[model samples]
Target: MTPDTTAPTLALLLVDLQNAYFEAPALAGVRESLIERANELVRAARAAGRPVVLVRTEHARDRSTWTINMRADGEGFAFRGTEQAAYVSTLERAGAIDVVKTRDDAFHGTRLREVLSGLGVSQLLIGGVSTHSCVAETAMAAFAHDYRVAIAGEAVASENGSLAAAMLDFLTEELRQPVLDHAASLRLLQGPLDAR
Candidate 1:
């Protein structure tokens, strides 16, 4: 279903687009392209006057909780307040809500759900790293909460391309969610939101 522009308030959820995830050797193959697509989504959301949320994964340095083991050839995980935890410079931070999450699911122990609800966000546009993990989890959570969820096809990636494709397919086919390209999403948001 197309979003209703007149009453459609969208929240762009950027999942775990941190430096460590991007710099990981396991994701090297699609890192650059993924970043580009994510940036495109951000630009589109901004032009449409949608609320943009930046979610980052933060872990304590002591490794007391879940241990993040970086691949031998990969740049290991970095804790919060480190350079590797910062968002890329290409993306604009103005008017964006920065949510620091400790877990894969953005809703778990985070103020994300409340923040979106407070903003009266009826639709959610999802994009970011680890298509099969964080992005998938957050998208599903948004669905469970009865929000109209749209997954930006090119803006999501996983270490395994096949896994990402399968998850995207599930969200589109089985879940009946819209997985749109950057251009289509931009146009939908820019146009009148009332049903045509």
Candidate 2:
């Protein structure tokens, strides 16, 4: 389908592109190329006048919840307000809605739904790190909430490529959401949000 150029009030949802995820030794093979692609998407979203939402993963100083269910090697990795929790430098911090999430899903216990609802945003464009976990969960949650969801495939990454591919495929085919490449997402943002 062609992109709508009517300036659809889209919201760019950046999930967990923080410093910790990038520097973690456990995530060694994740290509730096994904960060570049995600930055491009952020640029396009801003140029198109869409609202950008940066979701950061933060854990309490105690790190009780984050440590649970995590591998011992990656335990206590995302402490709140630490350098590890900050957004990457390549992405612009100004003019973006910044929110802190304690869990995998950004919407849980956060003002995300309220913020988007207040903005009258009917569609959500999502991209970020850990495609199989936080990113995938957020995309599906948006769709389930009845918002049109689009995920930039190239703008997301995981510890492994196979898991990323599987999550993208499931979201596109089973969930029936649009899993576009970075270029396609940019084109869509340029067009009207109402365009199919």
Candidate 3:
């Protein structure tokens, strides 16, 4: 697909790859593989000098930021100051920038937009957990912001397999956001962009 913009900077945005979601009962089967794929992309991005933005979700202990489902579910998901909200050890990199968001959309109440702007980023390579939720939301927001957005399919997962598949397809077919495999995502993250 042709790029939507000519802005010079590009970044790998890893959304909500925290321990809380991985340790969930429903996501056990695919968590490790997803993390591995994400790590591959992260390593490539780091080696290539592209910024790796770790966008995570952490809510108040009182559940002030949680949706009704999250409040009712009570798995202590992404609660602030808890280990669950923390990034997986392997996925956390020293030089990566971290942004904590309280909602599904990372840019909603966070400095993500400003950070990207500061870095002159006009394209975002997105990946990570709960494909049908935060991943999709962040991708949509990024696209709405006019950033060229591509999601790393292999690097993202969801508790609901069927919904996750549908979400990816929807993002690609309906939303015009490309769902890329690990290698293609790597090339995008590591390769040079067209001269601005």
Top lDDT model: 3
Give me the displacement of residue 167 in model 1, in angstroms: 1.2
Residue 116 lDDT, candidate 2, scale 0-100: 79
* Candidate 1 residue lDDT tens string, 53-170: 9998886665543435433334335576797778766656788898888767888889887777666677788889888889988888788888788887777778877888888888
Top of the candidates by TM-score: 3
What local distance difference test score does each model get? Answer: 0.75, 0.78, 0.83
Off by over 4 Å in 2: 1-8, 25-32, 64-67, 70-74, 193-196
Rank list by lDDT: 3, 2, 1
Candidate 3, 1-196: lDDT as tens digits: 3433444478899988888888778777777778888888988888777878999999887777877777789844677878988888777567889999988899998999988887778878899888999999999898899988889978888888898888888889987889888889888878975543
Taking every candidate in turn, the Cα RMSD to the unseen true structure, in Å, is 4.7, 4.7, 4.0
Clashes (N, CA, C under 3 Å) per candidate:
2, 6, 0
Q: lDDT tens string, model 2, 1-196?
A: 3333454557888899888888755454554676677777778878878888999888876656564566455667677767887877776667888988877788888989888777677788898878888998888888888888888877777886688788888999988878887779888777755533
- TM-score winner between candidates 1 and 2: 2
**Which residues of candidate 3, in runs, are more than 4 Å off?**
1-8, 71-76
TM-score ranking, high to low: 3, 2, 1
lDDT winner between 1 and 2, please give it: 2
Question: After superposition on all CA atoms, how large is the RMSD of candidate 3?
Answer: 4.0
